[model samples]
Target: MTDTPTSRATLDQVGASVTGFFQDLGCELLEYSPDRAVVALTLAPRHLNNAGNLHGGVTATLMDVAMGLCGTWTEQPEQRRVAITLSMNVNFSAPAAADSRVRAVARCRSGGHKTFMASCDLLDESDRLIAFGEGVFQRGALRSELP
Candidate 1:
């Protein structure tokens, strides 16, 4: 990530280099700030189900990841935080075809020092809604604080 002029710009600098489960799912971080996050996934064969559409589990995972990231983002890298999903509800509206790209946009709706609520929308390439989710998350130990 390059040295950006603003926190939001800095967040946007991180592109498809997300690690762990995000990397495994081929997720690209498009934009992230205090209360919002946008992540795109490159759909593949493994992402589909028996009916040849995006699996509900995959959609739920994407939603959880987006909401968790949205709720836990911080300006200070060293202060990087984590959010554990307390509860989540996913509403599947449309089907996403294999090999098609989908983007999940998430927003933190409300929060305290220890917990937060967030919502996410999964959209196809044409911006059709694939799924919508809402979740409550609890703040967890920071990455730096992890043993």
Candidate 2:
């Protein structure tokens, strides 16, 4: 299904309910499906670095969140998947200006018993690619059996 503003809002609420981290970071989940997820963030002055552009850490955080959500789409209540970043490589293609809306689209590339690979692109409102990233996540055992 195509993502709508209402659906994105709902996902943001759900993300907030699941973890305060998103709300605190001013991040929102804009789209979600089995294969991908898109996260949005309104660039704020606080998100900028001394260089006067969006910080690399903020972009990395958005990428990681989007990738994790993509992996979580396949999770079942009876089973669970926990992911830890094994490696992440990011390339800043352009500076994300302040007060602009940024979207991070993450796609799952591959997976196995305990590892998943994903790639994400950070785009501005005009769909200009600002940064790109790829990461590997190490999945933990099912939650039911975990202490």
Candidate 3:
């Protein structure tokens, strides 16, 4: 894949381009800062599992995206970069039914030159915790950056 750096003026545009699937899943970038990020998605029929509730994978994805951005948002807006997930652990605490507006809030708990650790909590519209996740990410350039 080609890597194109994003400018601050186009953060939202770039965010959408990088994770189009999140958009397809009805996820939006609710808030972002150097240390934290919040993302939300409204549960729909397409987001449900056979049990008729939110799918575990969907929650995991939301957490992953939130935490990953927690690290990415640390970079200068003029510099385009991506966070590679080195490891991630997710726990589904409760089932979220369809039509629920779930939000994933994540923060970069710790970090160093090459790697960073982030944690996330998935909450329903009512602000109840539904899932939790943490991930180790490696800071890197997009493949397109390679000569």
TM-score winner: 1
What would the TM-scores of all predictions be? Answer: 0.85, 0.81, 0.84
Cα miss at 16, model 2 (Å)?
A: 2.0
Candidate 1 vs candidate 2, TM-score winner: 1
**How many clashing residue pairs, candidate 2?**
0
* Model 2 TM-score on a 0 to 1 scale: 0.81
Off by over 4 Å in 2: 1-10, 17-21, 75-80, 141-147
User: Which 10 consecutive residues of model 2 have the lowest summed lDDT?
Assistant: 73-82
Off by over 4 Å in 3: 1-11, 74-78, 142-147
Specify the highest-lDDT model's number: 1
Error of 3 at 133 (Å): 1.4
Worst 10 residues of 3 by lDDT: 1-10
- lDDT by residue (1-147, candidate 2, tens digit) is 334333544464446543545567789887776658899999999999998899988998899888877666633333444567889999999998789899999998999777889999999999999999899988765554321
Which pairs, if any, clash in model 3?
A: none
Compute the lDDT of residue 98 as modeled in candidate 1: 82
